[model samples]
Target: MSPATAVVLCALAWTVFLGAHLALNGRWWPWLAVSLLPPPLFAAAPLALLLAAAASGSVPGAVLAAGCLLAGWRQSGVNSRAVRRSSPERAGIRVVSWNTQHWNQGREPDRFYAFLHSLPADIYLLQEYLNGFEGGEVWDIDDEERLRREFPGHHLSVDNNSVTLSRFPPAGPPVPVGACSLRVDVRTPDGILSTYNVHIPVQLTVMNPLSRAFFQDMRRRHGARRREYDALVADLLANPHPFLVSGDFNTSAAIGDIRRMPRAAHDAIGANRSLFPASWHARWRLRLWRIDWVFTSAGVRAEQYTFRDPGGLSDHLAQDVTITTTAIEEMNR
Candidate 1:
C-alpha cells in the first residue's frame, strides 16, 4: 500500500475507534449528523486493525491503543470485578451500598430477598426502600419483613426511604436528617459503628417524570436540593462517632463540593482510577454524573472499592466496598 494511503487508513481507523467509544456511551449526536453514517463504523474490524497498528512503538500511539482497548473492554462486558471476592479479615467490616432501584421493582419479592441474601456484607445500606409509593400506601412491607426473617441475627431499621440491614442492633432510633438522610449507631462485634444512610434528593437535572414536573421551577428547586445536601454534611460532621457514610448522593465524584468534604470523607470508588472516568458524565451513557457514592470518616479504612456493572437490573451499578475499622484507627493515630 502507498505511504499516503496507509496514513489515511490509519486516521480513519482511529476516528472510527473513537466514534464507537462515544457512540456506545450514547454520546454521538453532532458527529452522527456531520458524518451521516451509522454506528457500525466503530465496530468495523479494518478500523480496529488500523488503530492497533498505528498505536504501536510511539508513546502517543500506545496511549491511543490503551484507550481503544479499554473502551472495547467495557463494551464487551467481560472487564469487571465480578468474581473478585472480598478478603476475610479477623477484625474488619464489609459494607455494600446500593440504590436497589426499589426492592419491588423488577424482580419478585422472593428473588430480591435471595439476591440480598447472596451478598456477604456485615452492613447493607440501601436507598429507595419503598415504604409507600404512588398513593400513601405501604409498598414492600412484606419484603422488609422477609429481610428481617432471613437475617434474624441482624437489626433492621427503616427511616423514611432508606433502610439499614445490620448484623448488630442499632443503639438508638434511625436519626433523620431532613427528608432524605439518616444516621444510626449500630452495635458491631468490635464496637458501636455509626452508619449514615443518605439518599440526597436526586438533582433536578436527573429527576424522573413526577419530580421533574414538581421541580419545574429550576432555580428554587435546585437551590433547595443543594442546601439540603450542605445541611446533611454539616450534621454528619457534627455527629460524634467513627462512621461509614453510604448511599446515593445524586452527584458526581468530580463535584467540588463533594471533593471538599473533610479529607476524612474519602470516596472508596475514587481509589480505582481506572473504573469511572475522572470527568463526570452529563447524561445517561454520556454519564458525567456519579450521584451514587460511599464516603468514610477518619475512623474507617477502605480496603477496596469495586464498582460492579448493573447487570441490566438497575440504571446505576452497585458499589461494593470492603472496609475495616483498623484502617480508621491507624489513620487517627
Candidate 2:
C-alpha cells in the first residue's frame, strides 16, 4: 500500500475508535467527541472534561484545568460580603435552602456541618432530614441536640422530617401545612419575617417500572401532592408580611404553576441552574433538573445566588443566597 493511503486509513480507524469510546463512556473519551455533540451537550461536556483533567493531568488539557479552577472558586467556602454580614441587625436577613440528602448519611456528617458553619444566615431551611423514627423507633434526640448547639441563640423546630433553625425568636406557633412543610414567623430588625420550610413529594414518572408503579400508588393514596403545594402557596400570598420561603420543591422553577407565583417570589438560584448532576451511571443519566428553591415576597430582592458543589457527601448540592429589601419605592416620570 502507498504510504499516503496507509496514513489516511490509520487516521480514519483511530477517529472511529475514539468516537465509539466516547459514546460508551463520557468521562475522558467524550472530550474528543465534544465537537460532534449538540451545542448544549458540548457546552456542559467541558465541565466534565475539566474535572477529569484536574484528577488526571494530560497535554492539550489546559482549558479543562482552568474551568475546574473557576467552578471550584464558588465552592471554596469563602463567605462573600453578603454572607458575612447577614445578621438581622446589620445587613438584611439571609435565608439559605438546601437538600442535605438525609444529612449526608452516605458520608461524614462533619462535611455537611462544615458547609453550614460557613454561613451566618438568620433563617435556615433544610430538607431530607431523617427523623430515624420511620420504622416506629424512638426519635433522634442526639441529632436534634447537635443542631441546637450548632446554631446557638436560635429558635429551633424539627418536624421529625424537616428542620428549621433560626437566630431570631419564633413569632408564632409552628403551623404545619403538610407532612413536608412548616410555617413560622421569626423576628427581624425590620419587623417579623414569615418563612416556610418545605420538602415536596418527588416526581416518580422518570424512574423504573417498579419505582414508577410505587410512585403512582403514592399519588393515588395522597390525592395529588401538587395541589397541596398550590394551596400552601396561595395561603402565603394571601397573608400580609415580608415573606421568605425555601426548600426542595421537587420541581423546576420554569414550570407554569411555579412561574405564576409572582416573579417577586422566585428562587435565588434562578430558574436555569441545574442542582443535580445529569448523569449518575451511564444508562441512568438524563437532562438537568432544578428541584430545590428559595422564594420571597415583593419586599425582598435577591442580591446574590449560588449553587454549591457536592463536598463528596450529598447527592444534591447546597444553594446559598443573599437577599435585600429597601423601603424606597421607584417613581415613574
Among the numbered candidates, top lDDT falls to: 1
lDDT of 1 by residue, 1-333 (tens): 754455445655675756554453212222212222322333343345545556443334444445555454423312134345544444457787777766557556666666666677888887787744432254644456677778887788887677788877888888887777778788765566788887765433334535545346444545555666676777767766678887776554312235335655766654433433322222246543356677777767777666555444455666667777742332331
How many clashes in each candidate? 7, 0
- Indicate the worst ten consecutive residues by lDDT in candidate 2: 276-285
C-alpha lDDT score of every prediction, in listed order: 0.59, 0.56
Alpha-carbon deviation at 110 in model 1, angstroms: 2.2
* lDDT of each residue in 1-333, candidate 2, tens digit only: 654444334334434533453344212222222222322332334454545444554433535334433433332212234334333433556777777666755567777788887776777888777733221342332477788777887788777367788888888877776667888877666676778887776433334636656545545423444555676767676667677787776544212234335545754543223333221112222434445667877667666666655554555656666767645332111
Clashes of 1: 7
Pairs of colliding residues, candidate 2: none
